[model samples]
Target: MTSSDRSPILPASAAAPRSDSEVERLHDLILSSLDDDQADEVVSIPLAGKSTIADYLVIATGRSTRHVASMANKLAQKIKSETGQLVRIEGLATADWVLIDAGDVIVHLFRAEVRSFYNLERMWGFGDNTDSTN
Candidate 1:
């Protein structure tokens, strides 16, 4: 299935469209920055009510503890340099999880095992909007 076939994995009242290029940039940055068992399983959850810090959430995983930190660093830098967005990262030391918070978007970088344990996508169930690559 393509991105057009997959839904956004968010709630109805709190959904919005974001650029496909931006998403691709983010996906590339994350993949290039980290090594992971599975990266495409990544999900970005809209947190309109869940957060006051950001409007949307992006969650991806790295293969190991070290990869998580590296991916977070590269992704954070990419966002900052490209968009001039301010970011705050958490849980980088252990690399179990690293959270990059950009005002409009929040990215969660996690170790694959840890990510599987958390199962974050379920928290942001999709409403009606389909995930389109366009």
Candidate 2:
């Protein structure tokens, strides 16, 4: 879904959205690991006809430098322990933009300005619909 589609509002009166559990699972897990204050965007990029990276890319964010590193480390550990997958993390030294490469799904955690300046989603060809409320 696009960023303009509206943030997935969690109703104060509902049972919560269970519609996309797998996506949320990964999203929330990563957020928790990073202690995310809020998720700017969680999007799915369909390169169905163009590539072979499991059909999607999930973009997210963390609150700060420490948070980014903390989240990256936690996510790497989680991936290893839960899925037996070894995720390679990068840009930890900068912490302004940290990336977690999980093969089919790549996750991005960034400080707000850094996110805008680099704009990886757009550069990656998603353009304006790049999911991010920030």
Candidate 3:
């Protein structure tokens, strides 16, 4: 199905048409950066109409706490440099899980074990089978 066929999941007042290219660019940057950092089980969930939090939700697992922290830092810097938008990051102190809130995207970086335990993908309704790693 094409993007046009999908309806916005959010209410009219909460949802407004955003520049598709900008969102797509940010999504692409997040995915590519995660891959470059060797993130495991990378998954992208399209949340345009499904949620108002962000246009997209990206979840990935890092090999360890250090990896998770490193990925989070790099991703934030990358987004800032590319879009000139400062991203908000949380949970970095523990490095077990890091949440990066970019304007158009919300990224979660977690250690493999922590990721499995939380299973945000399942909570968000995207099962393990949904892999958008193209």
Candidate 4:
């Protein structure tokens, strides 16, 4: 679907939008947290000029459902504690895939199989400024 045709995966926060630097800080915070959690094949896609849903799209894989869920929970906690921003989380019950909407940054944590099935990186045309921690 086109950017306009695509709907947001998570509802946008009603709070004021974050400044560019603030968004960058939040994005960095997420990357660091995922790295510390030992997420595999972590990829970051910049969506600032491409989508209005979020400034950045972060994709990461975990070994299993338990690992995905744990990373989601910990990331949510860290964002809240560090940024004082309450992020919205989804799909934690199944843990095959988890989505975290952290204002300017949207994070997806998934098992390897689930991640490959979706292939968000390719869908987003990932390249410019994208970073991977593997």
Candidate 5:
């Protein structure tokens, strides 16, 4: 099914109009944050009906490991300050690929080489049509 055809996997109550707007708000926040962080080849994949993990999957690349970690830290902090949600982060030590789980929006920050190797966008059916803001 197309990404837009998939229904969000949020709780029944969260399927209401209010929750939909919240999800959209979170998604927009994530995209803007990534852009502001200067992430390259940013791509957002709607996983609503396709995945139970989150409503949206955002993938982006950093110039290096430090950049990846910095982006993750900043994004996590932004999510917390904006939504009052404590985001879960992983792989910060290596900084090769950091994942931030912010309820409705999940973000993946990766080093250029690492991102190319994993190619989350292609795996998630985003193809090569990445929305690069670089």
Candidate 6:
């Protein structure tokens, strides 16, 4: 299914809408965590009106299964410790593709081949304006 059409594996947290700065802070935290972990090809897709699941969709790649798992684990811990927001993670067993649901930001971590196969960037119509990789 297309990323936009797929239902969140876990139900969204029932909380009041966050302010713009709050969401931006969370988004920035996620991106930085991934970057620090050496995530590659990171793309951030704004979902302000395109979807209700999250304010932003982050797609990234890791060199291998271990790398993907490590990134996902580190990201989850970082988000929780920094923002006190618990994130739900999936697909860590094989680590071919791991999904991190961080409230307003949804992260997808994949191995190089898996990332190319899913091509979430293309699925989400990512372009030059959407890339924020550092």
> Which candidate has the highest lDDT of all?
4
lDDT of 3 by residue, 6-112 (tens): 97554212434458997899889999999989998898888777787788889999898999999999988888798767777889999999988776788899998
Candidate 2, 1-134: lDDT as tens digits: 78999876432112232334554565556545544444555444544355644334556666678876776777788866765556777899988888777654567778778877876677665444544334
Question: What is the alpha-carbon lDDT of model 2 when measured against the actual structure?
Answer: 0.61
RMSD of 4: 7.5
User: Which portions of model 2 miss their true places by more than 4 Å?
Assistant: 1-38, 125-134
Residue 27 displacement in candidate 3 (angstroms): 0.3
Quote each prediction's TM-score: 0.60, 0.61, 0.82, 0.86, 0.79, 0.85
Candidate 4 residue 115 Cα shift, in angstroms, is: 0.6
lDDT of 4 by residue, 51-101 (tens): 888888999999999999999999999998988888899999999999998
lDDT, candidate 5, 1-134, per-residue tens: 99999976553223333388888998888889888988888878788777777787888999999889899998888877987666778899999999887777778898888888887887876344444444
lDDT minimum window of 10 residues, candidate 6: 7-16
Higher-scoring candidate on TM-score, 2 or 4: 4
Instruction: Flag regions of model 4 displaced more than 4 Å.
Output: 1-12, 126-129
How are the candidates ranked when ordered by TM-score, highest leading? 4, 6, 3, 5, 2, 1
Report the poorest 10 consecutive residues by lDDT, candidate 5. Answer: 9-18
TM-score winner, 1 or 2: 2
- Over 47-77, each residue of candidate 1 has an lDDT whose tens digit, in order, gives 5566654555667767778777777777777
The alpha-carbon lDDT assigned to residue 100 of candidate 2 equals 77
Better of 1 and 2 by lDDT: 1
Please write out the lDDT profile of model 6 over residues 16-95, one tens digit for every residue. 57899989998899888888888888889898888788889999989999999999999888888987777888999999
Q: Itemize residue pairs with steric clashes in candidate 2.
A: none
